[model samples]
Target: MLENWHDVNGLIGNSLIYFDRNDQQWHQSWIDTNGSSLALAGGFIGGVLTLSGTKPNTGELHEIQWRPLKLGRVEQIWRMSLDNGATWTPRFRGIYYAVDQQN
Candidate 1:
């Protein structure tokens, strides 16, 4: 589970991720304070965990990727496509590190 802070418009998001052994895939269920929700599923691809799915009732394709970096850091990128993936727009990009490394 994860939560967001200091988000614009006071929108807070919560997500749950898990790996399903039956299909050997990772799945994620995310919901926000604004009533938005998403369900994505995928597994490691080229060393990055990539998950993608379309938004409910919106037809917007959303993809998120997490890449591990050096020094116990990780990068997360979220993108969306409105035209069935013909084009993509970045929605969020963040780097996360351990608390002890926050210097």
Candidate 2:
């Protein structure tokens, strides 16, 4: 399920993103304006869910990304790398409350 898309000048648009259960991987092309569906990263098991990828337009890279332990949890982790994935800087790490559960 495609949640959203980054509409940049129409030419450089990318899908917000979603995890592909069948493939067990994410595609860079789905979110890249280039329309080149390439495997961004493979999912693995280590107690916690994980994902990684680089934004096509920004050329930013990330790895060992963590996800929520369960589907309804409010907390999540986010990281990013500016130097072509040489290093990942922790930008945001906190719990997110559901302001509108109905939505």
Candidate 3:
């Protein structure tokens, strides 16, 4: 299920606003679906980035660039440019999930 973006923002913001008035801990994480580290926050994973890309071939056999993000659904693109961005390929192109750790 998708996390409630508003709730996530609200609760986090509320805690921050009353930090000195409450006994709470603050931390962040950069977590991948397969449980890999992207970044560390307060000694744990807080956030992560997922990327993807697509390349269509033309008559010249060169690849076309990727598409941009739309309103509802979007893919994270990790395009491979071993040849420096002329003709390209996909490196990581799939659905990714991020896990947040709280104290």
- Give the local distance difference test score of model 3: 0.31
Q: List the residue pairs that clash in candidate 1.
A: none
Give the best candidate by TM-score. Answer: 1
TM-score of decoy 2:
0.46
Error of 1 at 37 (Å): 0.9
Worst 10 residues of 3 by lDDT: 12-21
All models: lDDT? 0.92, 0.56, 0.31
Clash count for each candidate, listed in order shown: 0, 1, 12
Error of 2 at 77 (Å): 1.2
Task: Please write out the lDDT profile of model 3 over residues 5-103, one tens digit for every residue.
Answer: 123233321111111224342222223343332211121122323222222231222221223344433344444554545766664454434445772
Each prediction's RMSD over C-alphas, in Å, is 2.1, 5.5, 16.7
> Considering only N, C-alpha and C atoms within 3 Å, which residue pairs clash in candidate 2?
4-16
**Distance from true location, Cα of 28 in model 3, Å:** 16
Candidate 1 residue-wise lDDT, 28-102, digit = tens? 998887788999999999999999999999999999999999999999999999999999999999998879666
Per-prediction TM-score, please? 0.89, 0.46, 0.24
lDDT of 1 at 64: 97
Which residues of candidate 3, in runs, are more than 4 Å off? 1-71, 96-103
Model 2 ranges with Cα > 4 A deviation: 1-22, 26-41, 67-74, 96-103
